[model samples]
Target: MTAPLSRRSLLGLVGAGAGAYLLGGCSGDDSSDDPDAPQTINWWHIQNTEPMLPVWAAMAEEYRGAHSNVTIEIQPLENEAFKAKLTTATQAGSPPDLFQSWGGGVLKQQLDAGLVKDLTDDVKPWVDGLLPASLQPYTIDGRIYGIPFDVGMVGFWYNKDLFSQAGITETPTTWAGVLDTVRKLKAAGTVPIALAGKDKWPVHNYWAYLAMRIGGLGALQQAAKDGNFDTPDFVAAGERLKELADLQPFQPGFLGAEYGSPDGQAAIMGNGGAAMELMGQWAPSMQASSSTSKKGIGDKLGFFTFPTVEGGKGNATDAFGGGNGFAVGKDAPAATIDFLKFLLTADNQRTSAKTGAVLPTVKEAVDAVTDANNKTVAETLASATGFQLYLDQAYPPAVGQQVNDSVAELVAGSKTPAQIVKDITQVAKSQ
Candidate 1:
């Protein structure tokens, strides 16, 4: 389930640089001219695969069966495809009535353009029923614009058997220990880490986590505040990542590896070709699906939160990740939210959890998570002292892309740690 919060104690962690913005929703005639009139909702999502795809379809069909007056048209596209088409649609000002949202600077950009609805009033009645940390990424400047269905953090997903083979007894809790583990794994003839370098974005995960570990959440918020990413903390993050890079710990030909390809990072992890990977909650399933046998590592898989840097400002419990949510477009019919509410019910969330793909955002549905590795993630997130969305989603597109690009080069040995920070700062300033 989502990052557990004891009721709403964590809501005060409104996140960094998330100061103030005048709340406003785009003005449009409500599609429902009559309260119970026939309605049609256009929905877009990126869950274009089995388990989730059919799960969403079943929910929509169930809603249609119950409410004969409603018609929901869903377009489940591939991740990059959804982003491309959504960009084109938003540019044309005709987005779907209900669409997917990751909730960060991207959502903020949509709001600033008056493209999405302000859900503060609409969701207030039951918003608190969900985990406060789950709502953090979707909350901006004191306003709620979207509702997350799943929330989690990025951490080390390791093969327990491989660790045991390497004679490692426990997961590392500090940066120095992690490096030692990597070296030990290498000494044991194991690939220390599985990275998708060709994809670029995946490798950036390490640098982002390092930034959080070294600088703390406020540094990130302050960087966003001043539009500057050239700080000692950030540079130090790059250097630390470079230390890992210099160890040559990634899988062979990792520089050309894709994430989901037959021989890519996930497959490497699933097939036990590597010791570990830095990834999100979905890694296990991705590894399973990409592996030759499609059975993955089974019970041999384990999860661990990112380690702390000895004297870093960030807490050991500050999580770095994000999740998927739904945003009601400005022009949506009243029935749109009615359907959304139906889909998010505790029973439905449990149904989603059983599929092993989603981490339910509803606090009451936490028990539905039964997988051992998933439960560990749920517990880790539940105890997180702070949360950070993925940098690619948390920052504006240009800046996020630059971070990915520069970090990839850093890992590829084309750019030094100093060069990457300088490069990212330039792009951030341009933004």
Candidate 2:
């Protein structure tokens, strides 16, 4: 099977597929003439925990107060739960009026089924005010299908104190330097890294970054197109990952650690039990929530982009990450889109940024990022030369899941570098 359409190819197919449909067969009337007319918007988001949970509630309240005719029914669910619930709803031919979306393969599936609305015209007025890269994943076939609130990349979140203790003066810029840093940390009797092996996605990041560094962004796209990942470059990525794993750099019992649990990877770093972790922009907030003091490591933390591998084709500035956004259901009311627009205003985005929950997509609101670590991440993302969405979101579900599974096996030493690529190729071909 061929891979899912890339952002570029998908943009070419917009407007040629299906005509836009209004929610509940309602016309685009705002009901301003009839103040008594009621409009209810069903919203599903995965920010079930604080400080975002309350932040979202307040935003909705403010919107409702201004527009008495509109009532927003918000359902906040955990990340995995939201995915399962959304799947069931979409498959049943009913999705939330506006719900959380990552806007890649899954969004494409919904679009193919005519379950989501094309928001090109709805968001065009202010879409340009947001970072272009932040909109990449949401813009399909030259049409806007979602609106991004947060955008960031995956990188190393390290403890400055630990690095200083290890006697390292600078962050590593190459794979060899990374290994050397790990050795230094080990020599100083500290955990070099924190990993949540129980969550396969975190482990997959290492392999994904390695693949991009060794083979370049085109390599992944070409492999996906050809349904073959068992190439020399792919194997080399796995081998490089193995080299790191062989050093036994991760914290004790990392093979069984969870991602956001009390003793998970984030917690380890937050509690200062480990020196570093490779994670996305939300890492700091997660660390804070999971830490014993509920304050994380604070200013002790520093962000650095993923290092390059010598002889690699990828540039060091190439980013690998994704962000959160909202997808409007095909039958969503006109007011639903309006509420979405309200949520993305510079003022509202800045409000969200102040909570340290998001790296605002609106260019003007980026200055509201008060957390120093998050600011560094945002600036790095702003200057990135290239970007690749998370592999699980970039590819079809089957292929993405298989990538995670195979990479986890490689990390566990149950599969060889070559075998990992072979297994992934098998899954991709079957899809």
Candidate 3:
């Protein structure tokens, strides 16, 4: 189970044991030697809804117009659909020329199967121009396999009016303060938080962030390396989450709710049913769409980084989140890489950001994040001292599923904090 890596190597230990399940694809010679040679590139992404959908279509159209000899075939699928389709394609030794990638253990798996291109040389000189933190998740084994168009972090997305109603003038900056704020918000008759226990992945975030804040990034890597998560700091994080759980701060039936259902976490936040939710950068748009009004809180929405843990080794700058990017397939033509670069340009990044659906990975495009909530996410990412991909995406499938299961039980009051840690350790050791 032990693996050697560099830099953010401590993160995204995916598919270390699944190598036997993957088959190698044929080495591609479909690429053209002439830069302007006529070719068709297959592009796949998972932005299937409005705002982003039309935006991508326009970008492809623009690219086609610029390169008259090039024909672009674009396919936009929903998130789950894309994953299923990609799994089928890669298993058959065929994948789109360029497709979406989240760049953690998943990227590691793709690389292991020789399904991805090594972009280190192709993107060099210019890749360094992107933000340092934004590049962390995409880099594996000291090489770049993908390019990030957006980068983000997880934090508290709150409603200004609800906070004001609860007499919370400022967002909590420490764990203790957050506990107090939740107490106040609950006392004021507002559901302090919204959670989706049915979707165990979201339940994992609280435990993950608390552990990062208390144990620091090294502690996580150390556990991952040694297959031991039964430590004081990890237990202490679960204890703190238990403290909040004891307050009964979440909306009723939270244990059964889904992430995007009518009564889900985002809907509760959008309809002002809950005071806040701990979510990623896409929280705002999802909330708006899922809300009954389709016009979420609008200006009433705000965001703040996860609170610091008092006396903890980590600070607010250590972030926990992942973002979207494009990875070149092994069979992709050289022109496919060029198209990816064109899509990530600063000017083009600005266009994507203006849709209020993305936060640019390129430093020059940060200014395009004019929405107040989005700007906060971008600023927080800009100052990140450390990063960890989402636990589900960062670890092997069996281990990640175990993490989600253990966390969900803890949230549901079925497992003790200590028991949860031991459960995770057992799964990691088995892996």
Best by lDDT: 2
* lDDT (Cα) of model 2: 0.80
Clashes of each: 0, 4, 0
TM-score, model 1 to reference: 0.90
- Model 1 scores worst on lDDT over the 10 consecutive residues at 4-13
Task: Candidate 1: list runs displaced more than 4 Å.
Answer: 1-32
Instruction: Please give the distance, in angstroms, between residue 423's alpha carbon in candidate 2 and its true position after superposition.
Output: 1.8
For candidate 3, the C-alpha RMSD (Å) to the true structure equals 6.6
- Residue-wise lDDT of candidate 3 within 259-365, one digit each (tens)? 66678877889898999888788778767767889778899999988999988987679988877788899988778888898988899999988877687888888
Query: lDDT for every model?
Result: 0.78, 0.80, 0.77
Q: Rank the candidates by lDDT, best first.
A: 2, 1, 3
What TM-score does model 3 achieve against the real structure? 0.86
Question: TM-score for every candidate vs. truth?
Answer: 0.90, 0.90, 0.86
lDDT by residue (1-431, candidate 1, tens digit) is: 01100000011100111111211222233555785676778888766554577688889888877876677777776555566788899999988888878888888989998999999998888888898888887899999999988877788999899899999999999999999999999999999999878767678788888989999999988888777888899999999998999999998899998766679887899898999998877777767767788778999999988999978999999988877788988888888888888878999999988766678899889899999888998899888888887787788877877887898999989998888888888888887
